[model samples]
Target: MPKTIDDLSTPCLLIEKERLEANCRQMQARARAEGVALRPHTKTHKMLSLAALQKSHGARGITVAKVGEAEVFAAAGFDDICIAYTVVGAEKSARIAALAPGISFCIDSLEGARQASAVFAGLGRTVRVLLEIDAGYGRCGRTWDDPSLVTFARHVADLPGLALGGILTHEGNAYQPHQAATVMAEARDRMLSVAVRLGDAGLATRGRFVISVGSTPSANVFRNAHRDGFSITEIRPGNYVFNDLTQVNLGVCSFKQCALTVLTTVVSQHRGAGGAVRFFLDAGRKVLTSDRAPLSDTYGQLLYHARTMAPHPHARLTNLSEEHGWGAVRGGSTLTVGDRVRIVPNHACVVVNTQDEAYLVDGDEVLNTWRVDARGHVQ
Candidate 1:
């Protein structure tokens, strides 16, 4: 029973309660003011308590990247959930059947849609399915500019057990300032073109089919475009709730807005080559998950001088092994072994997934310890 933040073991996840509530409130307000629904992607935190916080802040629905995550959220009383990944396999499809009727999900290929239709139709269930558009990520889904997108959407709508719910995209590659503008613009133009064509075909319309886009780096663009009366009906930014170092480097959110962090202790320290102060933190790839800022080698930043909330002036984790992180700071020799610190991971999504549970803290006090109910649902 870790009674306080200081009592917690090293290399554990922590969430600042006040900052998290603020993040959720602001994002929900942004979506509301833009006349679009805020459907937060829950893969970021994977905590049921945080998801409830998002829902209380007026999130219309929640988004998950896998069928298993959807099941976790669904079993927890989340009625409106969207599985935002192209699900595969019989076990996954059968799992979808249990979430039928109100469940919404994404698909990029006809064969996948056909398999879903076969299972759903056999079970006398029709699931809401969204066509996923690859907005320059190259991960999955048809490219936003794919010429066959409209025809493909029509074929999906024609499936007996699939309801054409909407179109969605994740601007995952829009991390840098240079890529943000171009990728966001491309998403708007290409998605609008596809939606308009689908409307023309009478299979789906803007009045009927939703147009959604997500990515914390492009959140402002999502709001502005929707406010300017674009076809966008929903925004699914996930990492906004716990803006990580990645969001900070991209200028999406400041460090203060970051609600999630890894608490660790300096187990060892020494003077390294060139007489720089080097330290080994108890956290490493297993705890922080080794995701760097986009296009950069920085593993993460440490809150130094025994200040869990004050970022060190220059210290950064440059390398990591399984259970140790190598860090060095210039002109800093006061750091000692056993000094507690907090680390801001480059990406928060992977960090939370690595933890079995997280301690919710307000200042030095542990408000509550919550299980990561939706963690590790990668099916």
Candidate 2:
């Protein structure tokens, strides 16, 4: 049956099948050329179908943010997974041990290592752990040159039921919306130097150490690092699969490269006394999300139509309430009640979390539906 946005309900998440496939293939190609393994972060889309597609494209594995998410992917046959966030506490530790055979994680301290040791030992399994190094993101991890790094590494290596997988970093600060390339490159360099320094200090054991670093903005940096002999073993970029307004603003991907969008319908229109046109859409902060990048001032960008991803230069998504998205165009819009429009949200990850399923479309034809199966697995 023929299916389009008009034929479906309003405020629905949509994924362009062609663009998403191209994005995956391009990232894989770049990784192959640069000699680094691609283990794309699956926290953005969190669908087993897309995860399978990534694996088919030669990705080494997948990265998730939580143990629950890793369990979701693992149950779906994604054996190799990394919970990039720190793994602590008994509840999450037990969950991690249950899925520990093929899963790994990031840790920054000896205490976290001990926690894993206790739980995994009780469960009779070992867990691979990577040291999280701070590469200027400042969210987590010790600084690259911190004197205590080697001490913590040695402590983690000595712990029972734990294997030092390697080192990794999230250059999350590179999402500056401007100057991202330079910042991303610098973060990669810092992360690479730390890996080299630690390796030289005899931190590598059992086998060749895995030096992984990435974020959507710093994905190219991983390529450049590999080409420059930086010995980076893996890259974990999540947002590259569905470039949103944030990625577009950071210049990581063009609007045409973005694959995910929201299909919204105009519910009402109002005109100000000064001759301004304002329209309310069914999609609001609950649907599109309010995660704006540094400079972009809207929840999402307005696409002219569902068939075309082109944005109306004058149209802007100004405000969003629980159920209403208020937008304005400088001149006027011909849109009236029940008109459909597509919105490229600012953050595809957050938007995906707000939905249960997404329509997979190839051009104007709806091909299938993908469940956000791992959504809300934030534990």
Best by lDDT: 2
The global Cα lDDT (0 to 1) of model 2 is 0.84
In model 2, which range of ten residues has the least summed lDDT?
A: 221-230
TM-score of each: 0.95, 0.95
Error of 1 at 124 (Å): 1.6
Q: How high is the CA lDDT of each candidate model?
A: 0.82, 0.84
For every model shown, the clashing-pair count is 0, 0
- Displacement of residue 171 (Cα, Å) in model 1 is 1.4
Clashing pairs in 2: none
What candidate 2 gets wrong by more than 4 Å, as runs, is 205-207, 224-230
